[model samples]
Target: MESSERQLRAQMRFFHDLVRKLAADGDPYAKVLSAPDNPYPAYEAIRARGVLYHSPLNTWVTADHELANQVLRDKRFGVRMANGDKVPEFMNFDNSMLGLDPPDHTRLRRMTVPTFNPRIVERWRGRAEAICHRLIDDILAKGGRFDLMTSFAHHLPTAVIGDLVGIPEEDREQFHLLSREITPLLDGVVTYEKSVSVHAALDGMAELFGRIVEQRRADPREDMISRMLPLVDEGSLTMAELLPLCMFLPLAGTETTVNLIGNGILALLRHPEQWRMVAEDPELAQGAVNETLRYDPPVQTYRRIAHEPVELAGVTLAVDDELAIVAAGANRDPKVFPDPERFDITRSSRNDTLAFSAGIHYCLGAPLAKFEAEVAYQTLITRLPDLRQAGPVRRRGSFIIRGLQEFPLSAG
Candidate 1:
């Protein structure tokens, strides 16, 4: 009964805070939470405010490239409060490396680093290429017209991560379903309906991985889970730690790549000359992927909490104060990338974007995501030269992890 009451209180507080923010003027962070189709304008508004605008939500917000980069790399900042309080339950990432500070974060991240090292990721290129070809074959068999996201973008990463994690092919479909249900929690749950659905999805994910861990223990295989089970048994890691890492891996590995492919393809298609460049020289697929990471990245906003009072860019942040680092905005800062608004595949300054973040929390799956995207673009341009948008594009109703929900296209 007390737990139910606490949940109710949290819900009420969330709704009230949401309403106040939406009603408040000049709060670009509020506009971000509203999840507009194009959040760049709100980001620009935040930039206009200053390097560090103390938001009505009581968080410091920044869109400046240098400042955002500083905050990301600063050791004085962390994902959790300095007082060691966990983030709100609705964020749904508590206990994972993403939600941990150093020592724990360092330990967990070290265990997984080799799995996604550039050298290790390169070994999977052939398999990734094979997966892309299989997906394209399926797309072509469907009479040339299909939703790019559902048919191609989502499947490639799902298959690749499934292979890496040892998820049986038969269980892959069900596993992805649970992942999709839980991803929106990254935006932080506001409504009771979303809260209920996400919790249920978390429960389902726990149960699914619980079974997988047990099976891998009984008869280990040459997969990530099998490798980690021994650590859990020996107490180098606890089941509590192991389970969340299991849940985090597939979610992180799949969702971001899904968006990266979708956003990259959509950007190329929108820029005919850029599409032609890649179609003419498929080697430019890597360039297209990099440019897309700058122009329309999968992740837009990253949150950090100040571990101690620190002065930054002429503003002082109090201990435990939160920061909303708008990476998408920083990606477009004219000071860093000349002609920042333009989407140029050949842009010389394309690699400077904060899409994968930086410092201790830099994306662990970045190399794999980039490799998968490079293969995807290379294969699509080579095999489906006639690819073009056939219908309206639909953006995901998310502000932080930006991407498409439906991107209709045809292979002419």
Candidate 2:
């Protein structure tokens, strides 16, 4: 048997023991970062805990690309691995659109589609650059010293998503906190205090969306929330369903983009030639973005259960056994992406990479993600001119979302 395959069988026994320990006295935080230096290396040994890669608690960590395409495409298999009793655990249920499938997903997606249209994306071209400029300026004004994660990568996406959703300029912080709090990757390891803050953020979002929905009902605006709020007024959308859309959009919108930008920058800084390539030929921004997604996908894993016995890579999974589609690992799978680890942006091959996933559940925010990164990096290379990493940076203590927590950069 192949190494990965052999490891899978061994994990069946090893993972159960690990889970038993974790259930009792394991420190989730310490266990998460136990192999922070090599996060992906240990994934093979952990997936056999009932077919789903169980984390210390509420874990979804996989990186296989083709499986991602299969799982994401099969809409019947939704996110049902939750352990929420008081409320749907992991992601707050709250009757959100994400929990709804088919007619609901179709209807909500139709309403949400207008905001992501090509023309609307074109409208944000300047807005995207403007946000980039504002962020870069903050760094420049600070004498080329800034936390790229907090100061730039983190702020721009929150601001941009806010602008898209009709959030007022002053209220961006609320959205930012919500984006961070709601990501399982970030808060899965949060303490009781952070848990309080996460709930507070959810409450704030619900309240904010209440007003926004009401405002849009009275007088529709050009923003996305305005476009979708009418359905609610017409009784087409209810609080239970609508709350998730309002919160999910910003969190989904900004969360991954922030990580993508941060990861892309770090990857390029590590590979100066690639940086110089983008710096020289501004057009390479798109390909560079694609490569970044393949190299270190922001959302590492998505899940699906076998409706029937499924044969994936010769591994026969039993019916109803949970399967983790590791987008990051899939992106690196040699079968799909040749020389997966070299970080070569110019290497052209079929990009069936599991970054955005595939099929019906393919990331709804993909068009937005690609557009945002293309615009942001194009501007970064051209405007910043001297963007370079300052020192060693750390990731956001997250196993699911991949990116740096602190990226210090100097832009001359």
Candidate 3:
């Protein structure tokens, strides 16, 4: 334990010093890492530098919409180094599909495609709507004021994902806590306290899911875990692979939707005109979701490494060069989105947003996340037509997984 603690402290100091060094050097991407609350200015600075800015951190960065899309879709780029090494400091999802390249990524992704495909995800709409109403019922009981994030936004995705993952209702709270603890690691920003919490959370999740795995082996159920157990027995997957896959599903599923709902509602409330449009005609809920995704995305950036030498927009990237693709910046590029800074629910070309990323690694859960947010907004506007901000909102300290930490609201 002492040795592990020392290692954790050392790692934290290293990242802190690295961030300070880069920030001092005026590295725009590093500015986004150090102070992420309003990264748009730094993104604009990167755009000012040109299509591709080489950061002191040695990664090629881009805020250009077309170039970002080209890099994400290009077969010459991948999530790993050319030598097949995983990027350091990223969440240890290396065992899961999120960290794998082709063949393995294709294999694991294919296994779960049916589960998150639009048709199957659409089947969960009633359950999602019911969950939303139930959460609002709790919010209404709070005497017209409450933290929307904890009382509603957070619970909606957690409950839905909990049910889908076959976690018992009694254990859902613990599951949510562990998932939140692990989310900060996504940004590659680590403090000593966060490091300790994340380690404990990972251990807790392993124990919790291990028990479920054994139970499903004994008594098969109609859920994601039980469905995949056959693959484990058939030599297609091992216990080593199954545990990480289980962990990845809840982590990825919950965080994305939770942030989507929170960020979307926050955007609407900040722009009352858009809020009024949705409140007056809830059919515009989908439009509200699309606009929210473009205006303030849940995920701000993703990384890709050149698997081979590639030329993009007058820049030559050598093999193994890493690029930080700023999706948030790309979503707001004027070339693709006119008046990109304005949040308009009625925008016609909102679908061009890279909010869910692009190409082979496009979010598998995008359909489910959008459906849940659409249901969430529609339900909130219909039930709490007077919903508005009740206090100052706090954004989470994660740059990669952008979201709210506290969002107080009044049902009014």
Candidate 4:
């Protein structure tokens, strides 16, 4: 094996051992997702190893926010993780907006950014509300306890994003499955089994998007896809760049908002006093959403690779070294946020909430996602009038994304 590949294998072995130990020890490390802190205990554990742990694939974890900002903003670290030989459950390689670097990144993000811009996303308010209203009605009609994660939380954003991105309501379930198979890309294991399913799903999506692009070409509409056609005509964006954003933008929009809604509600339920405050004045709900992001963000960590030598926190990383910016940890560093452990809904905003990521690679759907969370929560609070956690919130074991897998809730 090449030296980088050897390094990757060595690192993977070490991480596996760490995971095993954390699992055995339980508490903070193993239940990484159970609580609000970044890396859970994972950050501190890795920090103990050193400010930077050699990534098995030339990757290391930079859990410090300032260091994270330095890496993400400095333009030295590339976003793509060096995949030597292993293909985990997801092939985050091509198509997805999150995986690509600049030039191509510039083209892809440009096509969709206009659509997700605050002015445009603000226009999505009515459509987002309509979708939420229908879902809430369905839940209320059932008149019993419901699974918030799957039922209410999951469905609302998918419907909202589907409407916004021109995805037919019928295809959302399929998209959800495809998104689930691919979300593990950040976890560093794109297994063969998942690869088959994910490839099939991606092919189907690409084919579907191809057809849509063709339709938009023949008959333009008032959607983002139509607006993005000029880029394709200009040859700045190829089908690969366009296809991923088409699906990715919508999926990202839905996924993060869904988790934030679920996570925020759960947090308030655990802290009833907070819930009571929001119940009294729904405007505070927006603050609650921001707090939940800091407390437990939907997207956890993102990986970057160094092409040239880079110095971080006095440690000089050799060329080809890998780095994982634990956005979760960066959001909680005590130096950045006072009492980072406490869940204060009204904590003044920090310029950096690595939750949306940093540098040129920041999330495209951030405004849309935040808007959806605020709107969704407001509608629910006003409509449900009394929403509370109904059962234990189950968490998915995947490392990249965090939040409720099953958030059982009731509305009165």
Ranking by TM-score: 1, 3, 4, 2
For the record, the alpha-carbon RMSD of candidate 4 to the native fold, in angstroms, is 4.4
- The residue pairs found clashing in candidate 2 are 62-326, 63-326, 63-329, 63-330, 64-326, 65-330, 84-89, 95-240
Model 3 Cα lDDT, one tens digit per residue, 184-295? 6565666777767877888898898999889888987767788888999999987887887788877888888988999999888888888888888988999989988998
Clashing pairs in 1: none
Query: Comparing candidate 2 with candidate 4, which one achieves the higher lDDT?
Result: 4
Off by over 4 Å in 3: 1-8, 90-94
Count residue pairs with overlapping backbones in model 3.
0
CA RMSD for every model?
A: 1.9, 7.7, 1.9, 4.4
Cα lDDT tens digits for candidate 2, 184-302: 52323333344456677778878877876777667776787777766767898766776667778778768889888888888887888888899899888888888888787787755
- TM-score of each model, paired residue for residue: 0.95, 0.81, 0.95, 0.86
What TM value does model 3 have? 0.95
Q: Residues 113-143, candidate 1, lDDT per residue (tens digit)? A: 7667788678889999998898888888879
Candidate 2 segments exceeding 4 Å error: 1-37, 43-64, 81-95, 185-193, 306-320, 349-351
Tens digits of lDDT, candidate 4, 222-337: 77778877887888777666787886777666778888888777777778777777778889878887888888888877767776787877788776666777788778888889
